[model samples]
Target: MSHHTAAKLSRSIISRLGTRGFSVNISETTQTFARLRPAFAIRNLSTSVSPNGSPKDEKNNSISSDKSQNDKIIPSYWGVAPAKLTKEDGSAWKWNCFRPWETYTADVSIHVTKHHKPENFRDKFAYWTVQALKYPTHLFFQRRHMCHAMLLETVAAVPGMVGGMLLHCKSLRRFEHSGGWIKALLEEAENERMHLMTFIDLAKPAWYERALVFAVQGVFFNAYFLAYLASPKLAHRIVGYLEEEAVISYSEFLKDLDNGSFENVPAPAIAIDYWRLPPDSTLRDVVVVIRADETHHRDLNHYASDIQCQGHELKDAPAPIGYH
Candidate 1:
C-alpha cells in the first residue's frame, strides 16, 4: 500500500489497542480522531492561558509577560498601604493630613459683602444667634488676628460636623442615600478644620486660648448637634449666618495685613500647599483664599436652609459640592 494508507492502518490499530487498555501517543496529524476518542487529555492545574495557548500558573508565571519593572517592587499589601506621593517638582510629598488632589486655587472673585436679609422668624432667630455669638469673640480677640482666626475656624468647623453626623445616622436608619449632602457637609467640616490647621501654624495658641477652644468646642458641638436634631432648617440657617461673620472676620484680617496693623508674615507652609499659592505668597494671600472659602461655605449653608424652608428634605435635592 501507499504511505498514506499505511499510516491510516497504523492509526486504526492504535485506536483498537487503546480501547483494550493499551497506552498510545497520537501525533498531531491524528488529533481529529484522537479528539473523538476519550483518551487524549492534558490536565491544566493553572488558571490562565498563555498567548501561545499554553497554561500558565498564576502563583509562578504570568500568562502575559509584563514589561515594566515598576510592577515587580509593589508588595501584595500595597493596596492597603499609604500612597507614595510626589509634589510638582517630583520631590517627596509631605503632609499626611491631606493629599495633593484636595489642594485647590481659591476663587477670590466671590462677592464677599453680600447679605441674606432675615425675612422670616427662622431667619431672624438664626441671624441674631450669630450676632450674639460674634460680639464676644470680637471682644476677646480684639486685634489678635491670628488668635481670632484660630477661634473662628474652631467654631466654624463644628456646624458641618454636627449636620453631617446627623444626616449620616439618618441615612443609615432609613437605608437611604443623602443625595451627596453627607459628603458635602463632611467636606465642609474638613475644609474648616484645614483653616484651623493653617492658622495654628501661623501662630501657636496661648494656654488661655487653648483652654478657651476646649470650652467653646464642647459647648458649640453639643448646641449645634441638638439644634440639628430639632430643626435642620434653623440649624443650617444659623451656620449660614455664622459663615457670613467668618467672611467678615477674614476681610478684617486681610485689611489688617494690608494696613500694616498685622505684620505681613510669610504664609505658613501648610497654607501655601493647601491654597496652591506662589512661593512669594504672604499672610494676605492666605486670608484672601480663606475668605473666599468662607463665602462658599456661607452659600452652601444658606442653600441648604432654603431647600428645607421650601418644604423639601435635603435628600430631595442635589448638593452643590466642590465649593472649596
Candidate 2:
C-alpha cells in the first residue's frame, strides 16, 4: 500500500480507538498528532554490527568496560525497589533517590526530530481533559479537580512544542547552536508529554468526556485571541498566571517524585531520573532548574505585556521569545 494509504489506515484505527473513551473527536486529532512520537525502532528487530564490522552490542559493551573505571559509580539513594513510598515514609531513602545529579545520561535522541509520534493511551484522555476544562458544566466535577489541572498542563505544553519546532527550524536555517537547542527542546517536549500522560492515567472514563469538551473550548479561546491579540498588559498578566500555575504544579509533582508517588505513575514515565541523575542531580536540583525555567518564561510575558500596552514602555524588557 502507498504510504499515504497506510497513514490514512493508521488514522482510521486511531479514530476507532478514540470512540472507546469519553472523548471521541479530540482523541482522533491527538492520535494523528505528528510531533508526539519517539525515534527508536526496536520491535521484532535484531541487533546489528558496528561500522568496524563488530557486533553493536559487543562494541557497546567494550565502551562500557573502558569507561567503567572512570565512570563515577554511586549507590542509589533510594532502595532499588520500586515500592510506593509515601510522604511520611522513610525520608532518607526517598531524598537520596531524588538526588538529581547522580543520574545516568538520558538518551533522548531516539525521538527528537524523528518520524515517530509516541502513542500512549493517555493522549486521548489528555485531549479530552482539555475539552472538559473548556466548559463551565464540567467544572462541577469539583473533586475531579486534578483532572482539570492535568488538562491545563497538556494545553500549556502546546506553545513549548511550537517553540521547540521553531528552534529546530531555525537551526536548520542557521546551523549555529541548533544541535544543543534541539536536544534541550526534545527533552522538554518529552517531559511535558509524560506530564500530560500522568494526568490522563490518573483520570477516569467519565472525566475523559468532560475533558473533551474542555479541549474544544480551549481551541475556541485561541481562535478568539487570533482575531483580537490580547493587549500587552492583558497578555502579560495572562502569561504570568500560566507560568505561575506551571511552576506550582511542577513543584507539587517534584515533591511527589520525592515521596515516591511519581514512581507509581508508570513508565515510559519522564522522571528527572530520565535525564538528570539522582543523588548527584537531586530532586531539589531538578525543581530548582524547573523553577528557573518557569521564571524566565514568566518574565517573557511581562515583557510582551509591556510592549503591547506601553508601546515599548519597558526598554529593559527581555526578548519576547526563546524562553528556556
Candidate 3:
C-alpha cells in the first residue's frame, strides 16, 4: 500500500479503537501497526514526528533516505538502459550473460570425430604438451564429469583471451584492423567460460578443487600469454589439441549419462537459454551440444594454426565470425 493510504488507514483504526471505549496508548498502537506493515512499505518511511515541534527524528530520516539513494542505482542518461528482450514464446528473457539473438540450436549432426596428426616439430611439441597436461587432469578428477569440466574450462578459457589481447595490441600498434580475429578469439573465451558456468550449476566442487582452479588459472593465464607472444602458431596448435581432448571428454560424459553412470538430470536453465534448447532437454542434450561446440573449437583452432603455418596472416583468410 502507498504511504498516504496507509497513514489514512492507521488514523481510522485508532479513531475506531477510541470510539469503542478502549483506553489505548497511541504510540503503542502505532508501533504495533507499523510492525505489521509490509517490509517494502516500512522502508523509506519518514521518521515519526512527536508533536512537540521537535527536529529530533529528522536526522535519522535523512540518514535513511541518503542510504536508500546511495544503494539504488538510478540510470543517469537516456542511453543508459537497453531494451528488454523476450523469448520466442513471449516470456521475458532472463539471462544477462547472453541474449536470445545470440542463442542458436546446436548442429548435433556435425561430424565430431576428426583428428590432426603431428607432421612437424611445432605440431609434435604442441601435441606432447597437451598430452602431458591431460594425464594429470585424468588422474585428479578420475571420471567426475562435473568437477573435471569445471577445472578443464578454467584452463580452456585462457587461450582465446590471451590470443585476442595480443592480436588487439598488434592491431593497435600497426593501426590496422584485426579482420575479426579479436572478436572471434574473445567470443571463444566467453563460450568456454559459459561451459564452466553450466558445469558449476550441476555440481558444486570441493573447496580444494576451487582452490586449485584459483592457482591453476593464475599460472596458466600468464604461461599461455607468454606462449602466444612467443609463437601464435604453437599456441593455437596447442589449443587445437586441447579442444580435441575436450571433445573426447565430452563424448565420454555423454556415454556416462546414457549408460547410467551419470544421472541424466534436467539441463540447467542457463544452458537451455544459452543453447536455445527445449525446456524439457536433459543433461544428455546439454552434453551433445557441448561436444558439438568442442568440435567447432577444435577445428577453428587448428584452422587458425594452419593459416599461420602457411605463412599467411590470419587477416588473409576470413575469420569465422559467430560461427558457433
TM-score, cand. 1:
0.75
Name the candidate that leads on lDDT: 1
Any runs in candidate 1 off by more than 4 Å, and if so which? 1-80
lDDT of 3 by residue, 68-181 (tens): 223342322122324466787887666777878778887778778899999999999999999998998899999898899999899998998999999999999999898899
Error of 1 at 166 (Å): 0.8
**How do the predictions measure up, each by TM-score?**
0.75, 0.36, 0.76
Worst 10 residues of 1 by lDDT: 72-81
Q: Which residue runs does candidate 2 get wrong by more than 4 Å?
A: 1-146, 159-194, 197-210, 213-224, 227-233, 248-268, 273-295, 307-310, 313-323
RMSD of 1: 13.2
| Cα lDDT, all candidates | 0.84, 0.45, 0.84
Candidate 2 — what's its lDDT?
A: 0.45
Best of the candidates, TM-score:
3
lDDT for model 1 comes to 0.84
The 10-residue segment of model 2 with minimum total lDDT is: 109-118
lDDT of 1 by residue, 151-203 (tens): 88998998888898899999999999999999899999999999999988879
